[model samples]
Target: MTTPVSLTIPTPAEAARWAPEQIVALAQANAAAARQLDALQLEFQAMKHQIEWFRRQLFGAKSEKRIVDASPHQMNLGELPVPESSPPPPAKDIAAHTRRARTTDYAAGDASALFFDEARVPVETIAVANPEIDGLTADQFEVIGEKVSHRLAQRPGSYVILKYVRPVIKRLDTQAISCPAAPEGVIRGSRADVSFVAGLITDKFCYHQPLYRQHQRLGDNGIKVSRPWLTQLTHGALSLLEPIFTAQLDSIRASRIKAMDETPIKAGRAGPGKMKGGYFWPVYGERDEICFAYHEGRSGKHIAQTLGTDPPPEGAVLLTDGYAAYERYAEKCGLTHAQCWAHSRRKFFDAQALEPERAGQALEMIGKLYAVEKHIREARLVGEARRAHRLAQAKPVLQQFFAWVDAQFESQGLLPSSPLTTAMAYVRERRAALEVYLSDPEVPIDTNHLERALRVVPMGRRNWLFCWTEVGAKYVGIAQSLIATCRLHDIDPYTYLVDVLQRIGQYPAANVAQLTPRLWKQHFAANPLRSDLFEISK
Candidate 1:
């Protein structure tokens, strides 16, 4: 007694038959499942790409150069039927030639010329006697012209502890004791003098030396200085320099066109044995002066605060990377916003690993733009000439590039999350900003200038690691700003810092511009007191 199961086979019509409500529900469920699958796939792809990016950052060629030999005419995405033509020649049939030998000129002329122009450099002459006439008497030796050869030399810097002896003198008539007031030192009570403080700041910021190491160096030279004391001296020096730094910032802000960028630095302020991230926002002025400002975070508010004014001086154009923060700040301030073409190209360059064909096309087009820039630079075109050159050469290339981008979006088969799609969106969004360079000669095509100026922050970070506190980071920014600006003007940073430190206390605050590296070069560089560390050959 088990009831036999009825074995039945359903007909095609019965199998296909279903209630209308059931059919609709089944179709809706199928669509929902597909949608979920697509979402998961998109998420997975995004994660994969992110991991790949990190891997490349950790281990990849640092250079972004891409070499392509094909002509621009060959860079089309269309597929067409092949036309009948002569067959291509085999590689073996091609002609070959011997490689040319490369040579270098190593003969740097006249050793004396190196120090000849340095009037302040002390010269010591060593006389060499003729070996042929040994032990020649004064009567035998004849007074003749001399032959001299010069060789550059160096020695470790000498440090000394100056003990100022101010003798007390009494006036005979008034019976009042008076002594020449001791010359104003950078720090009144500190043992360190202006030169010492300037050297410390220069060594720390310009040479990327840490205070503890500098302290040890001094100890090795028989001068035992505590790290804390050195730190205090450094802070004091920077405090004196703060006014100059502020003046430079104001000058940079007043410029009609400027470039800006930021780099992160680890500042030890979170807690003991911990560090917090901070940023150095560097601004490049029209006259090639660079100013770095430190802030706890990279926010639009910090940018606004740094500028210290709304509606940035008329005709102001701020060139920067396509950071949304800049856009908001610019909009609120009524400043002209220009984006970096190099940044746009960088996006496409990174995408090359994922989508070579599309990325290469974008890179080639962008390369054309850079080529035009190279021509403009080689010609030293400026103002109207530069704008006209861009209009004539770059405008057409840009038109074609944008047209290609539009066509890519309109054509089917590109996923929104694809690297190429993302790059296209990035360029399209910043198209107006990117084109600003074509219209204005003062506006650079990229913010690479400011980025290069800010590189010192990262390089110094590599050597000195983190600043002890947020305030320390700010001081670092102030010192680095002056040092970098000095370097930009081909001025010796140590000399500039030392002279500025010695004179800044007495310099009128209203005329601080004279103390800046630019004006200092024009006025004080020719002074006999200028340092001969690396004097230029006349």
Candidate 2:
């Protein structure tokens, strides 16, 4: 459904209308629009495009990719067809179909009954007594094997409190009293164990559960715990992980090709009932690891801090959108800056309603580029072979795409400030940066990988909403970086966190990189240190 874009001024024109705020923004950007008739009309269409963009953000589908489907011709003038008295066509029989078998067993009332992984689960056996078996002799029952059935069962929360009862002994010689030093808590002399701390961090940051919610759940489960203690446990765990996070961040900085983006969060307090704004600059490395670095502002300085001050190697690539700060940083660092086709395509997609034919043509051209990329992946092209594939397949499409944009501009028919021209200019100007991926095999076509890695922040934002302190936000980044990297490597976040929380105290400081998810998978993940609870449960 299309939402109408409304303007405050009635009868602005019969051609287009825009939202009031969009008109104001356009007028501010182009001061002459409010004065000249031609500029006003152009701003009308431009603002219409802006209004559609806002509408798309609020109510439209999020995906920007497109498939080129043949649109039927919508007009036929001065055409007439003779009516023929033809016999009715014979009807064809339709085939009967059956429903696909599902995983849920309705009769037994068990969900996921068909997809159970038997090897991973330990079986608990229960014996049932039948009246016939009561009367039968033991020899008769002993002669036959038993039949069994399986059902997946679950308990809420699945948390167990270990009531440790350590023996207390007094030394008779010196009247010295002693008990096993209470198994070390993450906090000095605190009762909370490393296992509890690991679970709290995983549930809060990785699962996106806020501490107050966990506190409420703990209360519901008859376990009395304060919300502040959970917060403190999280801080304590992250404090131990700060060095490892720094080490991983260094590894990400050393990668040849990287993608980076910023996201805002409400961190710290501005005033009463207010929040100060901050950003997390997340960088994705070639080694398949990501680091989320927190900074108070979105600027080039933060980019320099995360990447480096010195210039990158001769062929290093950095993928990003047309964000000005990234472009500036890339230029300053002498990196081969590549732009995202998805970002360019998104602009034309948003302006589809304003100029359907132009937008459709641009979209069809961009679709060809993506199709070449799809074939490259399907063929499993790698290294120099991948670069050669892009050169042979994608390079021609890229050339055609840019030449089409240049033709549209040279024709001099489109409004100077209209969305279509703006989109064409955008692609035409970035031709150099957008063509970088054609020659470099390791560089990705877009920053979607980095965007995906940083999504935990936004997904968790919906649940937790905001952070009370900047320090809390930093801790959030620290935990999320490792957790996100763990996911990239297909490692379990809960298992990794539990083992590291126990092992970090004794792990060598110089070998801290071994604990980062990328290195840990290769070295330490085979037989990681386990908490006392894990050992006892086993």
Candidate 3:
């Protein structure tokens, strides 16, 4: 019922005698096929690069440092090429230099000497008797000097109750009774001492101990306390500290140069039997101070609100990664946006396994930029001098690097989806923002500082898992902000928290800035709380 279709095969002579238009069409078809093949090859390369990236993340070393090879053919981004051979150096005329043995010994020699400030640390002296002189009498031998060594000891944490004795007196005239008032506490009528509260907080946030574990520890130590009670005590302490936390935020906002980053946190109260995701946006200030702000979502509006304006105040330079939200915020707020070079470098770093030659070229150029930064940092250059140095050294490298990126993009005919093409586009789009550092000495080359600061949150999350409520996560952010800032300034978190907890109530609200870690160091540099005071009474 259906007619069969037949095709005729053309001979070589018949095909050659075809019209000019038909020949042109055949040539165009072949060209199109060639283009498609090229596109597919590019896509395959991109997929290969992606697979390598995942493998590196899952199995390879986490460090960004590339391995060094000693082979003559090895290439290095940080140094010059090695020579094939070198001449031997001239032999020294005299014997090789030798030094006389020194008599003075600079070794610690004893554990007690290991302490930089022995006066600050508690020391217990033990009397040692010589076994050779058994049953020695009072007139046995003269004592010349005693060798002193110390073994550090620690006592398990235990709860102590302070019985405040307020004497009550009765007046004979009117039979009126008067009693001495007790000092104000972090939480009124709560039996927990300020030091106890501080220890609980530091244990949870700084040491990454969960409150449940601490509760068990307390019970194991023969102190009966409920987990809920401990949680309440922590909340109460954080409530009192809310003002100081606010002040720190204000201080951070007032900074001219700030670095911003965000990390995830899980809040358990968001849904029934399921955890709700949240974010903690950590902002690092110009003075090395860091503050964490909690938000339900990582959006530009939340960031804007935290900074206290839709656009941050004028004259502020905000450093961030290549997040489009940040760019939009910067554009709206009129703030100087400085993108992170380390972020751009990471793209090429990830592509190295598949495109080593091209990636290495890009990395070497970026490495030169960092080398300039290293030189300036080593010289301790700042302000105009730092800017001048960057202009003199880094600006030229940047110009050449960008030009090379543009050339590669135009001439290579890479697919749009290729990783290398994506990397080039990333740099090409943010070229101006990346160059902001060359003009302003205040801007850092990367957001590595903020990224490093964010590590604490992730570590804390691993131990504690998640917060019970949004408010609890916020409290965590506040406490962690202070603790991390203390560590940044080399201040002991326990010492800072205890002192601040005891004094925060008495400190005037208008003068709350003094309670911040950086300002506190300036005010209390010479009179830090003694380490012995942090110890529990025996």
Candidate 4:
């Protein structure tokens, strides 16, 4: 009852019925239709990939960790691939051994190092008077070790003000007043004490508490302070630490191998009530130090500015993600550039949904590279020895992986611009860069450490939002650089800031490197300067 929708195709006989001109036109039309169909299919697949990406962003697991099981319900598109494994090594049985409790003898004589560990907390003592002791004389009842009990206690409003009340005295002969001058503070003629400044910067940068929120907290605590005053205090505290940050930054740049990456921050004003974007180029040094250098633009020139325009020292290497700027910089500067393996693996990860079998094969190969890195860490290999092991174990795996990728290209089964082909092309192009880590022991197989250090930037942006100005963003970098480095060195950021803030004003400019957290840990951490209130409590 309905009209039939039949697809028509032109055959040789149908063309034969037409004139010569008509036949040529029909053949051109048919070829054009084939090309159009291919384009449409490519577009369709791209849209599907984008839709799946958005869905993952909204609902899927954020971790890129390889999954042990595949095709779990509700997780089809972006599920990570776990590599196929060979048979496990045979287990060897061991004789059972007795385990000891962690607590044991420690701190004998003048030594504090102990086999048994204890929490590092302040001790508060109180004398409990016994009624029996009140009735007995000192000689009548011998004093033995008293029973000890412990309970953890905490109090709110823990803030304390350091009051340095100076005694006023007058000379009888000259009528001159004399008192000890106030100790060096973080800022000149500023009411904000070093402890207060340290806490403000630490809370804002390290803890992501914005100035407005901090102002509210102070108001709630009965210490009324202006928001502008807090901002000024932060600026002053950061300015004091700039020299040390520079020294550490130089140390990072001078390392034999280091990581570099860029992250965006909304800094400066675009128009009324709007912000412009800037980037933080964070460099992670081999010594575990980091620096967040702020820039108005992300370009290869900035990388040169950080690493230098000159040819680097021999054997110097730069580790980075697959960013073009780093590639250009390293090439222009005549430096050895190594790419992250994890990034190459990520491309295949995204394509797994479309080309499950092919992408799975690629992911499994890359996963073996990670497995080698894990074993390297487990063995605690370093220097030449680590390099040797990687050459012996990791090099062969890499060779085989590249061979597979090359075979994929020669087969020519993957469509041009398709996800599978694109991933394979990315790996094939960077084969040399990917293999650089295998040759150098110091260069990490990935930039995960650098990413971890720079995480504070993005996490902070969520709470504190954007910087009011580009200068403000630079100040943010300075504070974060020091705090992040403090974390790497296992030093308490609050204590480090308090000591350095008080010491920096009087410290020699030529020897500012000693004020850096790495050097300060050795020079002054044993007996650091303290707030007057804390000293009195001691």
The candidate with the higher TM-score, 2 or 4, is 4
Best-matching candidate per TM-score: 4
Q: Give the C-alpha lDDT of model 4.
A: 0.77
Tally clashing residue pairs in candidate 3: 1
Q: Scored by CA lDDT, what does every candidate get?
A: 0.76, 0.76, 0.77, 0.77
- Clashing pairs in model 2, backbone N/Cα/C closer than 3 A: none
Task: Give the 10-residue window scoring lowest on summed lDDT in candidate 2.
Answer: 147-156
TM-score of every candidate relative to the true structure: 0.75, 0.76, 0.75, 0.80
Q: After superposition, how far is residue 124 of candidate 2 from its true place, in Å?
A: 18
Tell me how far the alpha carbon of residue 110 in candidate 2 is from the true structure, in angstroms, after superposition. Answer: 39
The stretch of ten residues in a row with the least summed lDDT in candidate 1 is 528-537
Task: Report lDDT (Cα) of residue 440, candidate 2.
Answer: 88
Candidate 1 has a TM-score of: 0.75
Model 4: residue 526 alpha-carbon error in angstroms: 1.6
Q: What is the lDDT of candidate 2?
A: 0.76
Residues 1-538 of candidate 1 have per-residue lDDT tens digits of: 1222333344778648867886676677666666776777667667777887888789977788996666866745565556689588766766889987855333333343332222223333334444433454555444333333432221226443332333343434445544444444667766565556777888888888888888777666545456788888889889998998888888888888888787899986677777899888888999989988888888888887777664567789988898999888888878889999999998899887677898899899899999999999999999899999999999999999999999999999776798889999999988999999999888888988887788888889889999888889989989998999998999987778767877888888899988888788998977724322223212
C-alpha RMSD in Å of predicted model 3 compared with the true structure: 13.3
Better of 1 and 3 by lDDT: 3
- Misplaced by over 4 Å in model 4 are 1-7, 10-18, 70-157, 169-184
